[model samples]
Target chain A: MNKLMMPIRGDFVAPRFDLATEILIVQYNNGTLLGEPKTIIMDRASDEGLCQMIVEEHITSLVCNGIEELHYNFLLWKKVNVLDGIIGNWQTALEKILDGTLQQGAVLYPDEREASSYESK
Target chain B: MFTPDIKSLLEGIPCPAMILDHIFRIIDMNRLMEAMCGHVTDEVRGIHSELVLRSNVGNSRDRLFKSVMETGEPVSTEGDILNCYRRKIPVHYHISPLSNSENVRSGLLVVAEVLHVEEIKKEQSNKSFSSAGIIGYSPKMQQVFNKIPLISQTDASALITGETGTGKDKIAEIIHNHSPRARFPFIKINCGALPADLLESELFGHTKGAFTGATRNKAGMFKLADRGTLFLTEIGDMPLQLQVKLLSVLDDKRFYPIGGEQIISVDVRIIAATHRSLREQVKKKMFREDLFYRLNVLYIHLPPLRERDVDIRYLLDHFLNKFMTGLGRNIAGFTSEAMETLLGYKYPGNVRELSNIIEYAVNMCKKKKVGLEHLPGYIFEPVADSPVAAGDDEINHINHQTSQPQERPPSLVVLPEKTPESWSDIERQMIIDTLKKHNSSRKLAASDLEWTRMKLWRKMKKYGLLP
Candidate 1:
């Protein structure tokens, strides 16, 4: 089972990791959901606290937008795969990530024409 | 939910900052920088900083990015930028490497601190005019100072010869800043660092499809520094073939860009500097004699710091005060033994070495005075016949100059010297003192420090400051 956490702003991923306040934790296996996603709202964004939560919760992978090099290195050092600079809806990103089609720096905006254009590329 | 695009993010920033790609093309800039340009950030995206910035850019040949990549260290430099209104803003910018976990060259984050024109004038109001932060009191230094304004009045191709770390680069900048072409770009490039082909591209730029990586038409340093100064450092080490190309540019104020049809004419003042003796290099057939003669129209040689009497003590005190202010420490004058070690040491590295030593001492010193223990290990290690052994007269002179008998500056009120503990014991004491003064109110303590409640909470948690 692959356990992933996405720091979401709303329908889309937060534009930045240090500024994110809400996160969703979900478990899946082979492109199918293993459990209902759990949402945790933070009082304020803290890279330190978030790193601790990722470690304590045993998150196998992380999906977020922009991340500083230090935090990214720390997560990688802890063996957690990080997908950063993703500009897309959380649901669409989840589907793509599950099917192993999501790129690390993907920009999958909600606009169908734009998203389809990226797909064509 | 407001998802911020680049435009929105840039608009929100109050200070001047820009996102630049690896090639030094600005990808996006904040509203503050945009306002200075009198154009929107989107309009100027992908433009070179030399074109966008209206100020004299001293090192215009993609220096910050290249240096950061070479050393993985951030670079900071001072220059004058002209905005759209033609108002000159003297800016000190730190170019930090912005990269993801994978690649180190994602982009560059340039954060600029603009200095007030009045402040610049006030800084120069001292009887001895100091330019580009290079100050001197000795006769030789004063002579160089006198020559600066005279050189600035004319468009002469000058050569500055000096030992490494003797502030030759600073002198070049001072000359350009005081020159008639001060309004235009003052670009510099080190011929010794990059390979000849890369240096050629940087100096003469390249047209699109000129080489494998040339994606767009790029303007060279000569073009960027048109009607301004171009500082060529370490000219002796410049490749022989490249020297001929450079000599051609010197003979005629025109250069052909790599893979370009047209010749670009430029009117640039060349101020070349080198630590090596060109005369010996010419005898050895290493440097071009004609190019050397061309660059040597006017000569200024910087004396090594060891030879400059009393300058050692003066520079030590100056750098001590500077580093102390930045670190918010009250490190007093050096102890007699420490003074002896510093004075007796033959500074092969010159002024730059002394500055580094003082900075190191300041950081290591947690006492009322910098002691011998705070100095670097090189002082203790026996070198080839180190200068005169510790003398009492020199100690007295340094102490007299460093520690003044007067109403001392209030901001640096000396506390009992204590070693910096993890998280710092002084900070814990301050937190406790502020909490007590505010009657145990965390909010008041947080506000007093200008820190958010969360930040204070974390600190309190770390130190167990609250019950």
Candidate 2:
């Protein structure tokens, strides 16, 4: 029952989503947010039916590679936990979640140390 | 009986029978026997059956015949015999000892049936196996069918770009089926089908304990499509991070499964397809530029169905045949009006959508021919019926453009606003009135509206046409 969620931004997600019809799924746990990182297809960039489906499915944590503002706000309004800015391999993001190292909310800046170390290099 | 008649009777017998003496010597033969032996000769008669079958008998024949004769059981042979004079022919020969009035055994009677070689070869050549599940006959499809062999000859990575339902997958299949590696498996994995992590494992097989769910070792699509083709449908949807990994695989031909140390290598041809403009996705920073450039090597842009209006009738007939047998129906075809209606609409879903529509229509159609009245109401409903509002906006825009008194716009300018009236108004007031004066339908409409029937229909629909 360790439900997880991950979002993928591009069509390159291992499991590609149909762009014409957006049908994406999110994962969650009991009261706690475990990133549900998954890819999905979309009819359009809209989330009218998607948000309701997520709430009905009782998804707690949504971990996606990216979510547009409209869908992001809709999920937030439903009180579903949202995690963003985690990138790289989808499983790696899930591992970070399991290890309790995944920072809550958006980590917009690519970590400070990693950025500074890159500058030095 | 006459000697010639007896000879003819012997030749007419289908069985290749021979007469033998007490010493098992050949006495007489028929024309069939001669043909079976490739030609009859005088040396062939009065010879022991052993000598005649010497070059043809099996290594175990003598034992079989001796045991049968000693036991007084009929010696039956079932095996192939290589006739020295003729070629090898499978023969079923039965030998029985002829008894005299005293019940003493005399000569053996041999009856053989030679199976023809040509008949078997003909049957084998005429055998028809079921076709693989690819289907299409439209001229556009015919062009694709023609391109399949050409695509197989090249080794470059191919990019299949087309609207959804354009049969990109079928195109990939055609390419693979015609390729040199057709015998190998053609693995397909939608880049957007799986989670990025699971997809990596799926593509490059994972070892046991590689991760929590990695119970046993698994082979990826690359392994399955080794030396064959890997069709990546919606490659445009691949995750950004995985895009980098995929790029690496394309360049180095190697990748490691999730949590696995060893890097596995595979030789698989990549054929990617997408409806979305990859250039737009790359600019949005959702797709990698390097990967797009890498995969965009050989681009094939399949034209949408709306672009090929001539193919509509061809596709309609093709689909009718496909679904008629499939649905267990004998519907004749589409009515002329239905054909005109179908040819008029701009199919947004392209071929796939058209197929679905036809399937729906076939299910709904009860009569022999599918007519316009039987068509889905949505098809006939103007675009104004939908929330898209594109039609209204375009009309208003045209009116605005036409109202500019500086220049007299073309006749089609006022077309949008004037066409929505009921068809009865048009037929009664415009068509019939004009026809009464001109005494001709075509000449009247042409002179009055300055347009043809096709153009009239366009005008009628623009005016909320009834008929």
Candidate 3:
């Protein structure tokens, strides 16, 4: 069984990996879902605590939004598959990820056009 | 929670601005900020505000936007906006609450203006602090460096707060060094270091016969630091009664001698620092609220070393170079695995802890490159359930010792009945044999046994290996 974790905020991928106060853990066995998804709400934002959770739970893969290069490289060194820079609704991101349709910097929100559009000052 | 197209509205602001959530996550940043920081808006959104604004004054509990978000008010402060090229553009920023159409709070909107305040940023005084060897290029530290120039020109009572090893004293010295009063004496006293009477006498001069030891009139830190700066450290540890006197001194620039009727006056710039939160101290009545307000004119917060994750590698190399030559060791560098361990370790003691670890490694390393064997094992034991393995030798030994049928039924393998004493004797013999095998090198023996140096030393002492 491959365990996957994703740091989350409200309904989207947490903007910053270290400051994520909520997370989701999903277990899969050979592309089959193992059980119900679990959400762990941390009492506070702690990068070290999050990393500890990943190791303790034996999570093999992670999906996050913005992570500093130091942590990104550290997780990679630990052999965790990191799909980084992904934005939008975290549930959709997870759905796309389980099917191997997730891109490195995909914006998966329903209103992707508005989220991407910006007016310069 | 923001309104529809809040990012577009934020980008329409005339100057550099950003929208941050309650946790200070970058909800969005405008084009000017993107241009200044050289981070793509799409890629940068959701990062911590510190990564983008690089505000030197913000900590976990003490940020301008945080205060605004909490109190539902706006705050305007002077800060240095750090750019991608390591350039600091002195800026004045205003952080206000971003509310939804229903008047419900959502996030914060921060607007900044580039300041032409070149006079304050001038290379003012040449005098250096007695302790001025602060070195870090982390965005937070760079913000701190930028703040010194801005705050030094003023005589505001700057409150420096952080964990114990965050160099609060050094920052106070930096402020004094860059200030106009750099030529005068910079007196510092830790309120918690001395008894109440002595602390009072130290802050305010005492007359002859004031106490049993008062044989002559003694000048206090306020008197000694005349026309200079007086750094009051651990102000939170100061007694409540003394807090009133300290507040009066800050209020009038004068204080009465401990035993004399005469009120002694002095010209001094105040710079106080504490590791504890003055606000919390006030709520608990351990620190006076009025006194905290007096000292909180300009606040500077130092983030813990672990939060400055990018700087860990740089600091490791910097400290290694610093301690290696001094320790008379030619340790080249840390191996990648060792560096990874250091990077992953959340240094609770902050920068000072890291320096000690580096120095210890430098002193212990026998090879050109410092490996896992040179580093302590306990640094990696805090977060994991797996015991820290020094190397493959330790792993092999642990595997050997643990593969003795304990996991299976007792009938699986024939074993002799042994008392605890006999087991200790066997363990002792094993340690001695391992030591002999490694040429009496305790470090290697400890590695082979999968124990910390201290733990191995205790076992060695129990076995009478040390005279």
Candidate 4:
């Protein structure tokens, strides 16, 4: 079984890790989810507090967007598999992560062609 | 919530434009808005406007966005917004209430004007507090930086006093570079490096046979610096006999070469520096009072690095970036624990020592981040327990085993079940083992450790291994 955490804003991944206050945690065995995903809302946004929670919860993986190198390195040192720079709906991102198809810098928005066009330029 | 007519209206706008529903969710955005926000229209459609805009002004609950929707009035303000990549961009935005054909308010229209975002980012990145290559932001350093230009315009003899490695020589060069005499030569002589007679001969020219070893006539530093600046470093170490000659030359702008009769006149600006207090030296009758008065006309003193509050962090990052580029290392930064250890250390050697420590750490770091193990062993040594007198500039010699009584307890040290082997112990053992393997040859040992001979020699001396 693996536990994954994603900092979220509404339906999408939060644009910045440090600014995120809402988190979604879920546990899965193989390709099947064991139970309902849990939502946790912090009183305020703090990268350090979030890191402490991640460690205490024993989260095996983290998916987020726009994380600073300091916290990223800290999480890496903690042995958490970090998939950063993800965008769009958290549900689709979670699905992709479960199937092992999601990669870092994945933009799951419906307008993939438009996002790619801007990125290329 | 966005009507086709409203979407078309947004597309007609010249600048970046978007429409938000009554709930503050983004309804639709024009192509220009998509480019500015680094997101496509479909990506952000129906999302909360705050999630997409990320304005510095609090959220949709803030007065700017809420007041516009509630009162049906337009609000124009200047602030910052985060793009899709989380980069803050300065902008001026106007939010106005949008109404249907029946005159019923449905949503709000927002138009943005980016205010030189790229230029503002560039300015912020380049806004380090520094002057003439000297990096310091403390009030004391700022006062010193402010005085450099004013003193540079004058020809008066200037005196600079600071602890060793506080960049006294760099300050002198900056003054000379900014002076009117910058076009001519800038010469420097260490007053403490030579003996009394040799120092005298170095200051004033000497004819052939001036001394037993003088086989040829040579120009002195004063002659070499004619019409320019002559920096006299470690001026307090100059012998008393030589001080009188320096005073005479400062007053008359003329001096005779040794073994020569005619006095040679030269126009030169004098900048003197010393780590010791000239006033204390005068009280002890070691330095001449008359010469001290002459050199103290324009004075500047640099505070030690430990006294600088925020500058330590700034210099750490500065030197880290510096050495990273020079060494071609991809090291990102120091770990949190390493940063804490570095910040807690009292740098007795001032800025120069901090720079050297960073260089050594960067060289030693193998991973992306510099860990506590990568730092030099000396930094972990405990500071002295003696209390420092307020306003005193002296540095107390650090005692490795003692704890500071007056200051807060050191952050990293605590009573433990078992004290781990300190980096100092590890380093000493490594040096000893390496030396034995190299057959006690310093050169071979240094090479094996990938350190310079001078570095190895200094380390050996620090460890009391010097025979």
Candidate 5:
């Protein structure tokens, strides 16, 4: 079976091992936790294109330290698995997960459901 | 036979209180209760407690009431949002088992009091604070506001000069939102908000090993704003030494992020704003003159609120309806006297201060309309006295020089020694020598003569051979 694809933070410089086939590592600015940090030039087919790269690159998993809920859901809907709370060496992380040595920490999904419940209380 | 005594006992409790019989029928209500629900008392009295509290009769309130009746226990609940006579209000309800001297369950008594509606409105308004974020429509503001879209039409740097709180940041936002690169990124850095070292690191970013606290490589504002627009607010506060480096970036879009050897090439548009006069800062040696000129291209000056007297009333109404809706109050509007006072006072904090004043009045108002009584105490006081007579004289001199042409033909009765004339004059010879040294370049000649380009152009156009 094809392994799940997750994005990793750019600062996770070391290569760690996990069950996933490969880690979709990325570098981005603060506040924008998913996808390309740039909003301009992303929709186009020319240089620095965003959508084209996401589709053509055969990306499957995104492992990051922190990913915004919007981006996490977008990746998941695109047939990509999102694994977060992983930092440091990418290779070691992958090996630890593959060999059952890494303690998979809890990944936080933003409590979007609580936002609407403010009126209830 | 004892029912009359029981009803009298229930009416003695203060506040809007109600008592219900064993069948959940309201037996009696207090004097305050009658005044509060005066017109609707007939329909409400002798009605089942459930019927009075529950209009739809099928919602969560009914379910809780049924449980309270069956269990024979006093139950209290809070915040059942309901639409009462087209006004949204929250009510806290209390239900208790009615008992006689024998301690047997007779019926249930329910009571409620209306919480402060203003408090709920305040919370709601906090959620909608983006009203004045930037939707200006006044003609004077429109003139400046309209030019914002034009800012993003080109990559050339723009400088916005205005008094504080004139919506300079909003103007910057308009430029970014309307630009060709709007979707990319628009980052703003307040130059005066930080110290020199911190500001530099924020603009240029730093490498992991660049500084003491540098733990990881960080992207600077310029790099983050790459391929987009970077708004630098309060540029006048930038240190003189940093001004030189910034000028180099304006001259050539190249810079090395701190501690990194890579020469990053960024296609970024710069939009800078300041409350201080850059020209004055340059003269004071606080700002670099060359850098000032570089950013001065496509200059925009926002008139202070005092100058745009027409916007006060319009903004006042705008803010009132805005705050009222946000506070969830059907406030008809501000009283004429209150609005007049607002218009007469010169807003030292500009539009921001005006919004604050309206917000403050809205919170303090007990009636539907804001009045002079609700106005802040300071609005009525005389403005502070001032002492800048020397500065006033300098300002007058500037105005005087600006009004009259600098190169007007020497007064008809000019002093012969002061006005040099003649074909072979030393001044004329020196002009020719400098002109030749500049290789006949008008720009170069203007620079060498220490004159404005416009002045040199006029001179050349007058003398001919400007090309």
Candidate 6:
């Protein structure tokens, strides 16, 4: 069984780890859901407090957007696998993590036509 | 809404360009920006700009974006942009407001230009003058820095003189840290903090049951600082009776604890500091002449922050960066008007006062830049036109004016009703008035004025007032 936590805003991952106030915690076993995911809302956004929650809850993995180096190092030191700089929908990122294909800095959004057009310019 | 015209405009820009909504959420970015930040536009289309750019400016990004949108003006600043790969690229950002066809505010257009490494190197070189966390580049401070090594080589009793906030204690610690006794503990005691009788017991130690409340046998500061450095701060406030005992200890390197029959000896180097003139204290029969000579064998005087004119701006930048990171606030810098006020104001409390002012301003400031309104009110208080003779009316007036409602009340001590030639005169007069108001009780005066007893004592010594 693996416990994963991801800071979320609406349907997408929160942009900044330090500014995240709502988090989604889910427990899964062998790429299958074991129970319903839980959501915790914090009174205020604090990186230190979030790190404490992750440790206290025994979260094995953290999927987020942007994170400062200090907090990233601290999470790593605690032996928590951190997948940072992941953009786009939280649902898509979660599916990728379940299938064991999510990578750091992954952009899971499907619509890349506009991006491709801009690149051709 | 991603319009064709805005998309074309972004593509036309040569440098990295991004369009942000009024709330600073990334709406779209050109291919250059995507390449620079290591993210595709579709993936971060609705994400906040700070998450993608991760600029060193921190939380100030929101304020800068809001300012541009509201004021319809372009704002520019220099900082590092941390991309997805955690690479820091020094860049200059220019942000301007984007309006709709009806001229109603809509969003923002941000352009980023990467700066050359040589430019960053030039700025850092100017900050090379620092030692042991003590930063100063002024000539006066340079002289003090030059003398530290020479003074640290000897075990002689040294005297350090400076105003209350001139970093005397830091200098003493730096000297001790660099000295041969760096391996040993460095102990410090403020002479002005305790009464003579209590100070005697604290310094020389007391036997169990020697006096009331002496429940256990205690090791004196001298014992704790064996083969180390003992720093005596506010030495001018050492009572006249205790001066003789201290003098004896310096000569014989031994002392008897109160009610102790055993002879205890300790080898400890003494470093004494005072905001007062020990020579003048000796002349007034308040300090012992022989003891003054013993402590003054090697003297180092620290000039006040005002005298080190060049250091003010340097220290301001240093403390700004310090507090910004500590508080997690992304303040770019002080507004020109705020900087002018800070530079022009007389720091009556010296470096300590300046540091406090900056901390307070940083906490109050909410925008990208700190403005004059964010500064403490005392900086703007009007100085008196002439020296009014000491009276109740003037004191009451000052108390009433400075008592204006604030998150932290300004000091209520009455200033000498005149454009005092020096800040010291104002501080001295204020201390005298506060002491008199509390019937000369140091504890009461300190409590009433929201200052530490040691701070009040140091100020009294600086003003040559008897405790």
Best by lDDT: 6
**TM-score for each candidate, following the candidate numbering:** 0.50, 0.44, 0.44, 0.47, 0.48, 0.47
- Candidate 5 lDDT tens digits, B136-164: 45556666755765666888999886656
Span of ten consecutive residues with least summed lDDT in model 2 chain B: B411-420
DockQ of each candidate, alpha-carbon based: 0.08, 0.01, 0.01, 0.04, 0.02, 0.10
Best by DockQ: 6
Instruction: Please give the lDDT score for candidate 3.
Output: 0.70
lDDT of 4 by residue, B54-97 (tens): 55554533455667767887878776665543345567777888
Please tell me what DockQ candidate 1 reaches.
0.08
Candidate 5 accuracy as TM-score: 0.48
Off by over 4 Å in 3: A1-121, B1-131, B383-467
Clashing pairs in 1: B54-B82, B55-B80, B55-B81, B55-B82
Docking level for model 4: incorrect
| Candidate 3 clash pair list | A15-B46
**Best candidate per TM-score, number?**
1
Worst ten in a row by lDDT for model 4 chain B: B394-403
**Which runs in model 2 stand beyond 4 Å of their true positions?**
A1-121, B1-147, B383-467
**Model 5 Cα displacement at B154 (Å)?**
0.9
* Each candidate's clash count: 4, 43, 1, 0, 29, 0
Report the C-alpha lDDT of model 1 over B1-467, residue by residue, as the tens digit.
Answer: 55447557656655577877666666778877765555566555554444455334434435655787667788777775545433356677767776644674645455454544543673476635543567678777777777877787788799887666778889898788767677567777888878899889989989989999787677788987887899999887899999999999999989899999999999999999877768777878999989988988887877666557667777788888888998899977999999989988766566777776787788899999999989877656644432322223422222232122122334332111222321245678888888899998866887998875556756765564432
True contacts kept of 6: 0.17
Output the worst ten-in-a-row residue range by lDDT, candidate 5 chain B: B413-422
lDDT of 4 by residue, A47-113 (tens): 7778778877889899987675557756764668889868677888999988999998676765542
Tens digits of per-residue lDDT for model 2, B268-344: 89999876668777878999989988988876656556656677777778788888888899999999899888888
True interface contacts reproduced, per candidate:
0.00, 0.00, 0.00, 0.06, 0.00, 0.17
Q: How would you encode candidate 6's per-residue C-alpha lDDT over B1-467 as one tens digit per residue? A: 66568788888888788987666667889987887677778777865566577566645656777788878888887876655544455688888888776776656555454543443552365533253457788887887877887898899999887666778889999889768676466888889888999889879989989999877677787887888899999898999999999999999999898889998999899999987767667778999989998998997877766667799998888888978998899999999999999988756466777777788788899999999999878778653322222222422322232221221324532222222423566677778888889898777887888875545655665564642
TM-score of chain B of 2: 0.54
